[model samples]
Target: MSKALDHDPDHWPRRLVAVTPVLPMLPILIVCALVLVGLVDGSGVTWVPLLATAPALAATTGGPRGVLCVGLLSAVLGVSLGIRGDAADGVLAVALASLLVVTLACAATSALRGRRERVLAAVRSVAEAAQQALLQPIPATVGPFQVAVRYSAAAAEARIGGDLYALVSTPHGVRLIVGDVRGKGLPAVGTAALVLGVFREAAHDEPDLLDVVARIERSLARNLGTDDFVTAVVAGYPRDGQLEVVNCGHAPPLLVRDSVVVPVEPVRPAPPLGLRTLSGETPDLQVLPFADGDQLLLYTDGVTEARNHDREFYPLAEGLARHTGDEPVDTVTALHGELLAHVGGRLHDDAALLLLRMPARTEAPAPREPSGTVRVESCSP
Candidate 1:
């Protein structure tokens, strides 16, 4: 749904493609038609007044120079037709005067349109660069899992929003986080960036997954307002057969094992980040068996909260089962497509989906030594 100005003609917006090419030539076409009409009717004065339309149409699609050219052409043709038809001098002068005024006015309008277009292009380029830095690209494969991500911003023109996700291969293992800020716009975006910055650094420094999350929480508490907070799920794959997760008031992640879709609800729910001081409860680490041929999905509330014309929330579990496949990219792509169709082609809120799948092992992979002891206080099937 994001509408960015594209330099490629083939990728230009539908509105521009339909209107841009024909407008410039419309002036000339109209002039030729008028000449034919004059030859048939034996009267040029009546149609000569209509020639003013030629320059007006040209103003929308061309620059000042092009408008001036079309205006000159219309004037020349009018003079010739008036002489041939022997029209009154006063009528011819009035017709010529109207055409001149229209041409000058249109020329100014064309110059202003061109200037605004250039400014828009420059702003779009800056936005793209900011997005690249904020949501650094992820590779198709990380550590022992296949990964895929899909994101949508409610403000399609900006192409970036409050929803955030990041996956990194650290000394500890494959670590990731998916979160949603409390609000929208620039404030939410700043908070998302803050969380990611802390997570990326802490994931590498702290061997325990809780410490990585705690670092983000502490940072947010010091920086965020009392009313502001972020709901997030921090997860890690530290060894061969186990996965660690800490859910902080966010949507439960879906686990796919043997074609069965199940939500991994937290054993002990904790307050969202930046609100821990109010609740005084720390998040519990839930360890689940992550064997080969299993896939896990992490998403923001925007995905589950989206409503259709029937006022029904999207059935994410059913959609995932229908689209699940060996390829992570293919599965996520199908889910994202179905999501857009459910919301009538545009989501009202920001949405993000990240799929992590452990491919079936053809041969046993060498055991990886655990970096640190994973303190698992709870377990989920």
Candidate 2:
């Protein structure tokens, strides 16, 4: 039932709200009321005169066809009432002419409304086209890992946002960046484009992960103002069994290793891109083991900061541990659905999630003593 309703973009409640009684039926009810009035008070002033109201009521309720139907009905009933009440022909003619004018005016209103609806539809189509261009779809697999992304824009009409993520397999490794800009609307989208453009170029050209971060920082510094900034997490799998991450004042990335989920926080956090002058520190680079069967989840603040009506934050780590598995695509899909349910259907801010899973090697890698310490967690922050 839920899926059926979801598939239908328009729900019952909205349809009910837009509904109106059949315009032709309103005239019939009005004629019945006038007849009742005349039967109750059989005076010289015939209650049949009230029949003029039928056409006006129909015009208010119906479109062009309805106006014509009600107009003819009102005219026929008016003529019948004149003869039945022993009224003059001039009185009936005047009443019928007034109803014709109102019906014509109402028809014009419906025509205007139809034109406006067509214009609105065209505008929405253009916006959707631009949205798809800006956020190109990502493939299911990239390099040695399976990748999945779920993004939702707060503004439903525009359907585009500043929450950004991109994954590219470079000479150094499969590099990825997920970030969110400071504000909302067109300005935020502009900032997102700048960040993605630089990241895509630098991810391929820059060998050192820090150099990739520096290139992005330079581009943002030159393009954005003091108030603008983007919090981001950039990660790379330079080799099998290893992952490098750089955090720039964004939510920590979740490391899923050996069935455990840990948020890898930057040892010394730097300010978001384009605001480095305030913090005077560069983003910290952290490395962790990316063994087979391990996956890493990178996301923006919109995910962690999402809250329910009771003012409770969504437990990211707990949610990750519950839904996550070996398949990155399935894990992210489950998490995105649960996240929407947690927030009661819509998020106030843009939300983004990216999951990448390392596939098992053909001839399994020999068990070598771990080279670096890996933080393991299964707790909530």
Candidate 3:
């Protein structure tokens, strides 16, 4: 997900170009109205004088090229009218000058447009670089599992936001975190960074997933402001096939097996990290079967809360059911595409998806007989 930069006042040049195409036409329109009135009043062809406004109008509106075209056409019309009215060389000089002015103005406007486009290009490049550095990609393999993560911020330009996901292999086990901060911009990012940093360190030191959660809550309470909190799910995978998940006011993870989507039941969800004091009891760690070929999908509320043009919330379970399959990466890609399509293009909040799959475990070998004792007896015989 990427953050959008604040609006720039330096875009005046581009704005001028955008409005230039219309401003020059006003004078020609008024002159044309006067010409039509003169013709309707039975006056001599005094309307021919209005032809002089055409080139300047075109130049101001369409720039130099437009002016040139309008000038040439106006000159042709003026010469025809002058022949009929027997006008002098002075009128012809004025018509030629108008054409020249239109051409020059178009050239100048085109140059300004080119310069503005270049500047915009440079600004966009810098923004892209910043986004890349801020939201570096997670590797495909983390700990003992195959991991794939996809993230999209509602703002197309931003590469990250309040929604965050991270997987790290620690001495205790492989720990993962997915959470959504309450707001956006630097404040939200700062909170997310704080939570992730604490989670990574605590995951290694704290053997229990609940302890890790508590560590994160304490960290956030100290760093964040009064109302700020994070909705998060922290999970740990020991060497065994079972996964320990602790939900702190976060969306339940979806377990996919044989293309079936099932929401992992939380033992007891606690309040968001900073709001732990509101709850009487601490969150219990829920154990879920995580055999090989099974995938756990973690995401933020942005995906679940996405609404269509009709104001209907997207059915994420149904969408997942339709797209779930063997390949974790392909499944996520399809779901992400569907998500964007569901909302008609981009999302309004940060949406993140982390898919972790455990490969099928190899069968244990059968126990061997006591061959050493039999070999010794045979050798003695």
* Highest TM-score scorer: 1
Tens digits of per-residue lDDT, candidate 2, 138-257, equal: 666677877777776766665677788888888888999999999998999988988888998899999999999999998898999988999999998888788999999899889888
How many residue pairs clash (N, CA or C atoms closer than 3 angstroms) in each of the candidate models, in the order given? 0, 0, 10
User: CA shift at 192, candidate 1, in angstroms?
Assistant: 1.6
Candidate 3 structure quality by residue, lDDT tens digits, 299-353: 9998899888998888888887887765556567677667766776647788888
| Candidate 1 colliding pairs | none
Per-residue lDDT, model 2, residue 140, is 66
* lDDT to native, each model: 0.83, 0.73, 0.69
Assess candidate 2 and give its lDDT: 0.73
Clashing pairs in model 2? Answer: none
State the displacement of the C-alpha of residue 251, model 2, in Å, after optimal TM-score superposition.
0.5
Worst 10 residues of 1 by lDDT: 372-381
What are the per-residue Cα lDDT tens digits for candidate 1 across 24-134?
898899988997798789897778878888888888778999999999998999888898889999989999999899999999998998999899889868867767777
Residue pairs that clash (backbone atoms under 3 angstroms), model 3: 1-153, 1-158, 1-159, 1-160, 2-158, 2-159, 2-160, 3-158, 63-106, 64-106
